[model samples]
Target: MTKRTNYSKEFKEYVTKLVVLDGRRIVDISEELDIPYDTLQKWVASYKTKQKEAEDNRQNALLSASEYKDLYEDERRRKLELEEEVAILKKAMHIFTLEKN
Candidate 1:
């Protein structure tokens, strides 16, 4: 049986980034890094999956933030409208009371 070599997590992450993010070919990276082709392929796949998950989470958070902003803006507009209406009603009441005096 061949001796199993243990690679550090940092080394694995670097190799994965080279393959997935840098758009390097698996065979080329494997040969250049002196790593096995199958191992490099697996690392690339894992990195891509993690990257996709992170992007999805970021998009979801942005959507939730946008929704909250929309709700806040709507409430702000409604409050302003109500304040204007109350001002108008108060002016009308003053006019009626002045007329009654």
Candidate 2:
């Protein structure tokens, strides 16, 4: 009976990074790391998936921030218009009162 090997997270992550980020070829990585080719390939694939997800999250955050800025500008303009209208109404009321007296 063969015992199963227990690998640590740091070791796996290091192996995956060597293959994916370091631009080392899979065949070379497998040979150098003494890991199976298919296993290394799977790790590289998962690493790519994680990188893509992170990029998508960053893009979404930038878009949301831009949208919030646009909405804030619109609200500011609306507030300024309302303030001007109120000032006009107050002036009209003052003039009306003086004319009546």
Candidate 3:
């Protein structure tokens, strides 16, 4: 029966950061740290998953912001068009009232 060695959370995170942030080789780190290569590899893979999810969330928020901006601009243009139409109608009413006087 083999007993498992427990690694601290901070140690695992630091090891993962070496790969995610420093772009260091996992095998080299594993050998240097005297940890099994598979363990280091799994830690880095987990960090990559979280990184990907964060990137995806940022992308989705950016897309929604752009869509909102486009919708606002469309509404602004429509409002301006309606204002001009109303001004024309008011001026025509004034002209007719003058002719009747």
Candidate 4:
């Protein structure tokens, strides 16, 4: 009967990071760490999934922020246009009143 080896979570995470962040190959890491190739492959896949999720979340947040900024700038421009229109209307009213007097 083959003995089952239990690896710690920290150890697994460290190996996964080496593959994911350090751009090392799974086969090389597995051979270096004396772990099974399939096991290390699975760990790398899981780490990649988590990294993709984090990247997607960050992109979504940045998109939302950009959209909010665009809306704010649009509203500010509209407010300035309205203020200019109001000033023009006030000047026309003043001209008409002076003509009538």
Alpha carbon lDDT at 52, candidate 1: 91
Model 2 per-residue lDDT tens digits across residues 73-95: 99999999999999999999998
Q: Judging by lDDT, tell me the better candidate of 2 and 3.
A: 3
TM-score of each: 0.65, 0.62, 0.61, 0.60
Runs in model 1 with CA error above 4 Å? 64-69, 74-101
Pairs with steric clashes in candidate 3: none
| Best candidate according to TM-score | 1
Give the residue spans of candidate 4 off by over 4 A. 64-66, 70-101
Question: Candidate 1's residue-wise lDDT over 5-55, tens digit each?
Answer: 899999999989887778889899889978988988888888889889999
Q: By summed lDDT, which 10 consecutive residues of candidate 3 come out lowest?
A: 59-68
Tens digits of per-residue lDDT for model 4, 1-101: 85678999999999999988899998899899889899899888888898899999998777577798999999999999999999999999998889553
The predicted structure with the larger lDDT, 2 or 4, is 4
C-alpha lDDT values of all predictions: 0.88, 0.86, 0.89, 0.89
- Where does model 2 exceed 4 Å of error? 1-3, 64-69, 72-101
Off by over 4 Å in 3: 1-3, 64-66, 74-101
Scored against the true structure, residue 30 in model 4 reaches a CA lDDT of 84
Global fold similarity of model 4 (TM-score): 0.60
Candidates sorted on TM-score, descending = 1, 2, 3, 4
